[model samples]
Every structure is written in C-alpha cells, then in structure tokens.
Target: MTTIADRVRELTVAREPFVHATVVRAQEPTSARPGDAAVVLPDGSIEGFVGGVCAESSVRAAALDTLRDGATLLLRVLPDDTATFPDTPGARVVVNPCHSGGAIEIFLRPVLPAPVLGLAGGTPISVAVATLAEFLDFEVAASGDYAGATAVVVAGLGKGEQDAIRAALDAGVGFVALVASRKRGAALLDELALTDAERARVHTPAGLEIGARSPQEIALSIMAEVVRAIRVDGLASSPGPAAARPQQAVDPVCGMTVLVGPETPHARVDGRDHWFCCAGCHASFTAA
Candidate 1:
C-alpha cells in the first residue's frame, strides 16, 4: 500500500502544491493519535485520517490557509470549552463544537514547487544566470519552455530573440527581460508587433543598474531583480490556474462550518443543498 510519505513524494515530482498534515498531539477521547498523517490537496480533499469528521473539517480549513500563504502552521483543534492554551506565533486555534470532547493538534506544512527560470542563449551571461539561479533555488529550463516559467531571460541570442520574447509575453510570464544595450533593446522591441501594454511588459536592458561589468556581476544584478519581483512585487503567483477557495456552508444540525466538496455529506432539501460536517449531522437534519 502507498503511504502518505510516498504520496507526498509523487506530488512533489509532479510539481503539484499540497499541504502535509500530521497529528502531533491528541487529547483523550479523540479518535486521532499522534503520528497520524494526511495529505490535503488544493481542492480540499484529504488522503489520510487526522481525526474524526468534525476535526477533519478544521484540519481541512487550516491546511488550505497554509497552502495559500506557503507557511507552516500548528493547528490546535479544541472541543468547545473555556480552557485555553498559550498562544504561539505560528499556531492557529479552532474550536470544534462537534468534536467528541477532545482536542487534537496537527501540523500543516505547504509544499510548493520552486520558481522556474527560462533561459535563452549560450552566451556567457546566459551561463552565469543559469548557474546563479540554481544557487538561488530556481528551476532552470530552456527559454523555449516558458509555458509555466515565472521569468524568462533572453541573453544576446543574436537570432530568434523576438520569437522567445513574444512567446513569453503572450504566455503571461510575469517577468520577461532582454540582455542588451539600451539602444539595441529598444530597436529589438520595435521590431515586434505588440500592443502598448504588451510592449511595456518586456524589460529591456534588464537587471538593476548597479554598474555591472563582468558576466557574474551582471548575473547577480539580474537575480537580485528577480528576487525583488518575487518577494517584493508578488510577481510570481502560482504557475497554473488561480487557486480558488473551497465553498463552505454551515451544518444546520450542529452549527459547525464545513467545506463543501463532492465527498462532503450533503442533502438536498426543498430545492436547496444543505451541507454537513459528518453523516450523522446529515441524517439528523434529514430526519428532522
């Protein structure tokens, strides 16, 4: 049987974003135990058990939050009670009213793929950028493969530069740059038939103006700009379709919040759908 760890590895290889949830602490009367692990996909589906259905609801919500922000979170799910725990910087506390009088603490960590840099040309600057990008934890690929790249750099490729730049722009790659002199870059941009908005997206004379003279220095400046774009400007959004938050509803029987998904227990009543955190709630609402 494939374990949760094995599944995580597969997802990593596939460059899919997911949250790894592990039960680190469980109070008495809870069904979950320490070391229980699960993988939460972007669509709010779980592959393993962390706790009972009610507790799972809380885990799913917190897992999605961690995935959105790319942060590790310590999720504390407590039975609705007056007792309190010390506040931790990276921890989130949720009171599960439907829980069976117990608490579980689960750790949620988001695993995201590294940003990919599409590099063109075999010039010295191109070689330097590739080497430096790897050191900065970026996945390097050929400039032709800019379909999902966060950034593309066309380095002095004498020919076919316009093709690569046009493709990257059309694909909406966040950062597109050309390594050329100011005059030459402007001339190249003019050669391409692009709209004003599309023309403005291309960065001519790429990299920070740090008076760089050597290939390595120029590479450093370019990487610095890329980092600014990612960290400061939020230019590197997730590569694929925008992640949409799961629809949510309240369980009328228990007043517990639940994520609405295909697998969630729900009932249609009077031409409307009523969601439930567990099957018991669904049955109770239907019976009433």
Candidate 2:
C-alpha cells in the first residue's frame, strides 16, 4: 500500500494539483478514524480512504473544489438529519444520507503549482519582472520558452524582441506583453503578420499607466497588467453556460464542481439533471 507521504512526494515532483484530505475527528459508526488521510487527484479519484463510500464521495468533492478555487477546506460530514452542526467559520457542512450514523470531520488542503511567468529577454526590465514576479509568488522563467508559462513578457532590449513576441503568440500563450516605446512597439507590430484578433492579444507598451520611468517601475506596471490579464483570462475561459447558467454542476454530496458531460456521472431527479464527480457521489445522490 502506498503511504500518504509517498503519494505526496510523487505528486509534488510531478507538479500536479491535488487536495489532501485528513480526518481529524470521527464519531462512532464511522468507518474512518482520526488520522486517516487521503489524496484526491485532479480527476476526482481518491488515492486513499478517509471513510466508506459515502465519506469518500464527500471528501472527493471538497478536494476538487479546493483545487479549483485554491482554498483550504474544513469539511464536516454528518447524517441527513444532523441539525446541531458545530458552528464554525469556514467549515463546510455536507449532509450524508448514506452514513451509517456517524459524523466525520475532514480537512482538505489544496496543493497547486505556482503560476509561471516567462520572460523573453534578459534586459533590465526582464530581470526586474522576474524579481518582482517572484515576490508576487509566481515562478519566473527567463528562457522565454513559454512552454508551460501562464504569461509571457518580452522585455525588449532592441534585439530579438519581435521574435520573442512572435514566438509567444505563435505558441498560443494566453497572455503576452511587450515592453517598448509606442513607436518601436508599433513598428514591430507592423512587421508581424498576425491577424487582427491575434494582434489584439498582444499588450504593447506593457504595464499600467503609472508613469513608470525606471526599469523597476516599468516592471511593476507590467506585472500589474499581467495579473489583470490572468484574471480576465480566467473569467473569459470559464464563464459557464450561455446566459450565465453554470455549465458545470455542483455535486450535492460534496459541493465540487462537475463539468456536465457524458463521462461525468449524472442523475435526473425532479425533472432536472444533476452531474456528479464520481460513482460514489451518484450513489449518495440516489440514496438521498
């Protein structure tokens, strides 16, 4: 059997986002005891067990939510009739219909890889961006590879800046910005044969209008814009269904968001379709 430590090491080295669930409190009739731990992978699979199928479903759901929102969770799973749940701030309560008559408290924490910022040029501004990004808790890459970078910044040093920007855009990096004067930036953009949509993706004169003069100030402005772009990208990428309806369904058992698709387990109840993260959730939903 693989231990939690072994799984943690494996996941850490692989840079996969996961949630660690540990049972800190357990009442009678529960299959799990305090200290039981489990790891929930990105796909809603549990590598360990915190309790029986019912408890596992809830834990899995909470774990996935934590991964998505990058927030730690303290979950309390009780029977459907549980009324006097512990009044605690930030504690999520899950009503378990299939529980044998026990309560389980599981703590879930998300382990996510740091977002990467790729720097294309080794100019003073690039160096400053790297330093400042590090301060902002982003992993900085100076190679301009953009292979796995969430954002790329071309700190122009007069040579190869256009090439770097071209490479970044060609690679479909979600966010790309170039630091240069308006004239130089315009000239370089004219040279590139990018479509209007693609050209619009490039943020020329990268950074906010903070009147930045020095390389350090420019770096700060660029980072601010980068952060804004990241947030905008996130909102645009997952705006749910049209008309603002959520494309993803929240698993009622555990509250994890499940993309509505054939592969996802789902059930139709009360003339409505509900998706679940896993079989365990489906079972719990049916039982309820």
Candidate 3:
C-alpha cells in the first residue's frame, strides 16, 4: 500500500510537507523510467527509486529546501562524467542511471506542511529526551517514518550497530547521538565514509557528559543537549525568522507575499496571505 499515490494522499490529508523526486528526463539505455519516482516522507522514509543511491543522495539535500521555504523544486541530476558531487572533492562518479544508458534528470518537487519530529530510538535514555520533547509541544510520531525532520540518539553502545547510526548521520537527520566512550565513538566514526557535516552532527558519548550513569540521569543529559541545540543552533523545523518578517498580504493558495500590489491567487477573505508560508497555501486560500 506504500505507493506514490498513497504517500501523496496521506501527506495531503495529514497536512504534511514533503518532497518527491522523479525521473523526468532520461537518456537511452538507462534504467530510469519516466514515471519512476521517490517520495521522501516527512518521517524520513523513502519509497521508489528514480536513480537509486546516487539520485537519493541528491534528493536528501534537496528535501531540506521544503523545510526552508515550502517551495517545490525540480532537480536535474546529471551523470557526472567526472567523479564526485559538483563541489565536493571526494565523491565518486555514479553513472548507473537505473541500469539505463546515458545521464538522467530527476525532478524533486515538494509537498508542504510535513510534520517534524526529533525521533529518539529505543535507547534506555530516550525516556527523558522523549518526555522533554513532548513537553516542548513538538508533534512526535512513534515511528520515524512520519517525521519531516528527525534526530537519532544511539547512546548505550551495544554491538554491530554502527551502520544504522551511520545511515542516520548520512541522511543529515538534524541531530544524532552516541552515549559511550568518546575514544570509541571517534574510532567508530573514523571507520565510516562520512562527510564533514555528517561527522559534525555525530555527538558521540552523547548527552551533556554531566557524569550521568543510570538511564534516568543519562536521559536528562541527552535531553539537555537537544534543548541546547534548539535554542542556540536553530536546528528544529519550527517556523523561524519568517514568522517575524513584517506582516504582509499573503496569497494563501500560492503562498506568495504581496504588499499593496496586484491581485493575489487569493483575494482578501478577511486578509491576504495572513502569515501563510508558500505559494500552494496562497493558492489554497479562499477568501473568508
């Protein structure tokens, strides 16, 4: 039941914001089909494959755009004759365009209003982090699949689980944690092929390092770190400076800002955009 249609319908019904990447243009001999698409759920799970891993890499960064402006974008992912992302120096060239020949262009369009959550896995310490996150009034989902934004906590180092933790880091899931020896954390991270950004978000031996021992104490320290991130780093997805931007007439359906200007997609019901976010909102706006 996890079809493109189903995800889209769920997103619309739930009033979530999301990004869908599709293979719109393809060269001959490549595996990319016109309709092949990947829907990045607000929860961070992805369905379908426009271009497999390579394409997914591009999609991950592009999805964050929706969180910023609530705008839809069509990305053109071209096969790099030379290895590496445009600006990145270490990336290897990825050319298997879904087993098809030549390069492919993937279109990433966003669907807005996706719910954001800081998902804490079943760590013994998440008890406190979860509690504080809820008290902060964040809309949390039991499964990370429903979150628009996510944070992973991997405290209580066990065994053979670096891959899962690494994947979260690669996805750039806002925040990540590892409660254990910093020496071990550093060694573990060094074993992975990760970017600087990914490495940076990996807070190993997680928590405030406030000499916490038990699950409850550790949870407090971890939650404190998350709170610190919210206050200083602006890491959470909640509306930001845009909320403080001078109030202007907004077209709710299209979400465009209008100030004593021409007609908006939405006429004044009682007001214009009225603090609306995107063009889609402006378009959806029905006066009154």
Candidate 4:
C-alpha cells in the first residue's frame, strides 16, 4: 500500500504541485482523527481522507487556495450552528451547513518544486553556473533539455548556441540567455528564424552588467540576473496544465462551495448539470 509519505515523494519527484493536509484536531462526532492526512492535487482531487465528505469539501477549497498563494494555512471547519470557539489569529474558519455537528482543524501546506535551470554546455562558465545555481536551490538540468526548466543558459561558446536557444524558446522558458560578446550575440540572434516578440525574449551577452571578467564572476552575474527575473520581473516558471486554476461551483442543497473537477459529484437535471460536494448532497438534490 502506498502511504501518504510515499505519494508525497512521488509527487515531489515528478515536480508536481500539491497540498499536504493533516488533521491536527477533531471534535466529537467527526470521523477524522488527529494526524489523519491527505494529499490534494492541483486538480482538487484528494488522495487520502482528512474528515467526512462535508469537511472534505472545505479542505479541498482551502487546499487550492494555499496552492495558489504558496502559503501554509490553518483551517477550522465548524458546523453551521456552532459558534462557541472564537476565531484564532491567522487561521481560516469555514462553517459547513451540512456538517454533522462536529469540527475539524486541518493544516494545509503547499509543496512546490524548486526552479530548474537548463545549462546547455560543459564549458567552465556552465560548470560555475551549475554549482552556483545548485547552491541557490535551483535544480540544474545539464542535458540541454529545457522542457520544464524555468531558465535556460547557452554557454557552449557558439558551438550549439542557436539550436539550444531555439529549443529553450520553444519550451516557453521564462529566462533564455546566451553567453557571448555583444556583437556576436546580436549576430547570432539575427541568424535565428524567430518572430520579433520571440527574439526580444532572449537575453544576449547574458548576465547583469557587473564587469565580470572570470568565469565564476560571470556565472554569479548570470545567477543574479536570473534571480531578478524571478523575483523582481515576475518571470517565474511556466505553469503546466496541472497548475491551472481549479473551477468551482456551489452546491445548492447545502449552499456549500465546492471545487468542480473529475472527482466532484455531479447531477444532470432538466437539461442542466449541477455539481455537489458529496453523494449525499447529490442524492438529496435529485430526490427533491
């Protein structure tokens, strides 16, 4: 049996984004116990159980929110009629109308993969960049494949610079750079059959203008520029299909908001489809 920890490892290795939700506290009449955990995927599908179906609805919603903002959240799911506990600071509180008179506290943390830097050469500058990028918590892909890389640097000294640059651009990498002299870089860019917009995205004579002479210094300048592109310029990794925002719907039976996905319960009535948080809600709506 694959444990939650094992599933987490698989997701991490696959460079997928997900939310780890652990039940920290549970009130009476709730099915979930303390330490019960679940992995919520980017599509809002849950791998384990955190609580009852109604509580899972709240957890799913909050998990997606945490994934979006990249923040850890303490979620308090309470019954609609219960109000004894005061709101805790920095914790989100959700009252479930369909909850069976119990409460649950779940901790939601988003696990995001580290940024990948695609280095397209084995030159001294490329070696230095790989070392520095690893130190800065970047995953170095030295295979000249930029499929999922957030940044790509061509330091092959004009050997395969054009092909690498074209591949990086086609991969939709946020930062595409080539290490060469200003004159050579401009000439090389002109050689590529790319549109004006695509050509503009490439950074020639890569790295910040820090007067870097040595290979190590040049690597440092390149890393600094990559950091600026990520932090200041907001050029983070290109989001995959799984990172798309989850669609949502409101369950009319319980007035609870639920994520609309393959896992959600659905009903077609009178030529219209209605989504529900759980089968119980779906049954109730269909029966009435």
**Top lDDT model:** 4
Ranking by lDDT: 4, 1, 2, 3
TM-score of each: 0.94, 0.77, 0.43, 0.90
Question: What are the Cα lDDT values of the candidates?
Answer: 0.88, 0.78, 0.57, 0.89
Looking at candidate 3, the ten consecutive residues that score lowest on lDDT are 238-247
List candidate 4 segments past 4 Å from native.
238-247, 261-263
Return the clash pairs for model 2, or none.
Answer: none
Give each prediction's root-mean-square deviation over alpha carbons: 1.7, 5.8, 20.7, 2.3
User: Which 10-residue span in candidate 4 carries the lowest summed lDDT?
Assistant: 236-245
What's the distance in Å from true for residue 183, model 3?
1.6
Residues 1-288 of candidate 4: C-alpha lDDT, one tens digit per residue: 999999999999988889999999888899999999999998788999899889988988999889877899999999988865678887999989889877889999999899999999889999999999999999999786677788999997465788888888888897897999899998988889779888877898899999999999999999999999988887878555655667889999988999888878999898988999888889999999
Error of 1 at 249 (Å): 1.2
Worst 10 residues of 1 by lDDT: 234-243
Candidate with the larger TM-score of 3 and 4: 4
> Considering TM-score, where higher is better, how would the candidates rank from best to worst?
1, 4, 2, 3
- Tens-place lDDT digits, model 2, residues 185-251: 8888888877897788788889999999999999999999988876755612211122222256777
